[model samples]
Target: MRSLYKIVHTTCQTGWGEQEQRIYNESVWMENKGHQVVIITPMGTPLFTRAKEHGFRVHGVSFKRFSSLKDYGQLKQIFKDEQPHILNTHSKADSNIALPAAKKTGVPCRILSRHISDPVRNTWNNRKIYKQLTHFIFTTSDYTTQHLQQVFKLKDMEIFSMPSGIIPPQDLAPKESARKALARDLCLDATTRFIGFAGTISKDREVDTILKALKLIQSQIPHHIAILGEGTPDCLAELKTLAKDLGIGEKVHFIGAKEDVWPYYRAFDCKVLAPGNKNKIPLEGVPLALLEAMYSSCPVIGSKTCGITDIIVDKKTGLLFDPQKPKNLADMILDTIANEAATLERVHQARELVRKKYTIDAMGRNIIRIYRLHQVKIARQYLV
Candidate 1:
């Protein structure tokens, strides 16, 4: 077993996405097992500050993506000071900062986890670093690494697939009251069938496609959409206009964002995720939002992108729709509503699948195994 000092670095802690959440959640879990997991993140709010004060260590560093050479060199000083046994960097940009630090400190394990599958940053310089400086390039999917290899020729035994695991959203029967209260606050009819969606509804979401689909189906069914996200003014305005043009503006309510999403999940009869490919850069992988939705006994409809395919089994646990077709989203939504038993049975299976394969505890165990394997390899290398 490795010592109780494994330091990881990322950008910040204000945003509560999978990338930020997992890094801390896994860190805390490892800490519980007597390991110290320090993360190099920017400042957090009072709540996050309190949590850190309790036990977990948070190192503040202003490491921006478009930073100068001095930024990386400054972070390198942290590695030298900490002398961490393992240095795990979350993003590729952050990897750029952590790379030299790991090299200069001679940290045995420097793992870079690729959370997104964007091909834009799969650069020659990064590939060379993966070949030479970095210890391993840990990716979320084999499909992701395959594309990276095809485009940038970053191939190695060191490149491995390691997905972030899903934690079942907290269960709350009393929380049902909170869901009803939110509906009341929104002025939604007590009888309306509410379908919901929650994610980064930016340009990549293509939520207008879902809106068009909702328009197609609204004439036949009495349903409401409860959206949960915030984005730029332009994208948000475009979505509002799309809903207004579809004649369902009043029926669709934008909930923006909430710290606790379980209440929203309980209020939703179904969940929808509509993602568009940003250029050829495929947005693939099992998103935690979909897993949380499924875990909450809600059926789901997702796009056929590689990442989402890992969890969504069409007509089984959830439905897969063509992102380009307006009617496809409508058809799937209607079908999911029509077959409530099958839809719910799929939810049950999805929850079970997550329990077996995608729990945070399972992910922690896998990560520990990977660390041990790498450590053993390191030990044999310098026995002379």
Candidate 2:
């Protein structure tokens, strides 16, 4: 018989980022499967709002810093009262607080979901905290899991790799209707071959590369660039200047973060992900946005990176580009536009790939399996 578990997710994120969506998807699936779930986030934040909108039990606490005593007390008290089977936390601030609180409250499973590949500062305190955690959950496969194990030296700790899952759109509108709606909103012509880049507009995401590539093929293709997601005002301004410098300022449109980016995916001819090398913590996971695009039947041109490699089968499912070489990205864009029939075929195959391997249902089942396996392992250790 399947066991029902009480799962609590804690995060310090204020925005509706990948981590927030990931938890929301998992919680929905687990709840349907008879698991009780609660999400703890700061009040009035986008994540908190979305969790409430989705009917998930939510607790709002300040996530201002790592050492907020008041918030820590509240979190610890909640853990004690709830007595959750699993306390899953995302981000460093939440993880540090939740791990100790879970231990103090005698929570059986304390899993820290590390979403990025950024190296944690190797300090005595951090090492100590890492050693006490019950398990580490990595969103990416081998790259991040192996890197963190080496960094934190968690040879004995249990770890699991679960890629972030996306809920596919239920009613996919036709390409013409989507393009018409986007064009109407953005004031572009219907014939425009819209290229899109979704996710945060930070420097690490390399939105500049998309702008530069658009400039390279501006004369060759009747195209416009639509950048979705939010970023710091300074970073947004910097991208605007880059667009002007590349002489494609008018062709590039920044439609700040949207509650729904599926329509944009529907309108895009090709989706692109270009992460730069300059980031302190480089992009390393299979981006949920990439999976969404693939599921929407939009072909992708992703940088050859860890997570991207796992999904894209180089020219079969989606095209892979070198982030360092802007020209490589430009070439792929032009090729995708030129070979429309072949690109559509690839998009179809990519959709099948996402359906088979990356749906929310699949992710939920895998996570439950992990929980059960961990329980059995602990039971065996106790018997020994």
Candidate 3:
């Protein structure tokens, strides 16, 4: 018989982004697999409400940075009461509060999940948190794993890289059907070709590069670009002005965030991610948007940087371009359009890769394996 364990997951983020979604999904999967799961987040956040609605035990704490004594005390008491087999912390603020609490309570396995590729400062407090309080580290990409290792001089066995898995849609609409439905809703012509950009609409995402590339190729291909997801009002206005300045205003459609993005993925002729390389640290970690698009069989194009390269693989899985040069992105877009058969082949390969490696089941099993290994080590130590 398999061993059943209780797991506690904590996060400080309140928004319903990919990171929060991953935590919710992983918790649900574990619960369904006969393990008990609990969530600790700030009150009234989407994650807190959703987990509560789904019938999981949940505790809310303020998760403040400067004045976190109350939060730490609450977490410690909860850990003592529950005595979870594993305690996983998702964000920095929560980790700062929960890791020490879990350690004090003697939680058998403590994990710190690093979800972004941004650099970690080599501070004394960070070292203690990562090296002493936490038992093992989980990173979303090899980029982050190597980054943490280099910064804190952590050994390979101390950290593992695993991208959050996506749940494939059960009933995906046919491509033509999806395109026609999206066209009707967006008031576009049924025959209009679409290029898609999903995820946050921030400057760091480099959406202007996509707009400039669209301007360069509009006359040649006669395509439209759909900008999905929402951003700050100022960011939205800046992108709109840039599109108008480039004379591609009418061709660019900004459809804010959608609850169901699968239909949009199915409707897209190609999906793109164009994060800027100007930041001192890399900003991506195997983007979930690209994974969803690839699973939907949409040909993808991304800048050759950071975790984007982990999935794109240039011409094999999808195309890659330089974020610094809009013309390079334009050429990649044109190449995808002109070579339909090759693009389809790449899409097939990409979808297979996501299925084999990036599915929720795969991630769940890997995590459980880690937990079981730790359990065995603890048992051996007790025997000795």
lDDT top scorer: 3
| Candidate 2 residue-wise lDDT, 1-384, digit = tens | 239999999999887767877888788889998999999988998888978998888999887865477777888899888878888888878877777878887888778887887666778777766666656564465567777777777663366667887787789889888988888888777776699999888888888888888888899998889899889999999999989988998888999988788888999989999875434445667788899999999889998776787788888999988887889999999999899888988999999999988889888887887788778877988999
Any runs in candidate 1 off by more than 4 Å, and if so which?
Answer: 3-5, 12-16, 42-55, 64-69, 120-123, 151-157, 174-179
lDDT of 1 at 205: 84
Please say which candidate is ahead in TM-score: 2 or 3: 3
Task: Give per-residue CA lDDT, model 1, range 262-341, as digits (tens).
Answer: 77877777889988777756685568788778777778899877577778888887899888897988999998889878
- Residues 212-246 of candidate 3: C-alpha lDDT, one tens digit per residue: 99998888997899999989999999999999999
Instruction: Give me the candidate number with maximum TM-score.
Output: 3
Q: What lDDT would each prediction earn against the true structure?
A: 0.75, 0.83, 0.91
Q: What's the lDDT for residue 116 in model 2?
A: 80
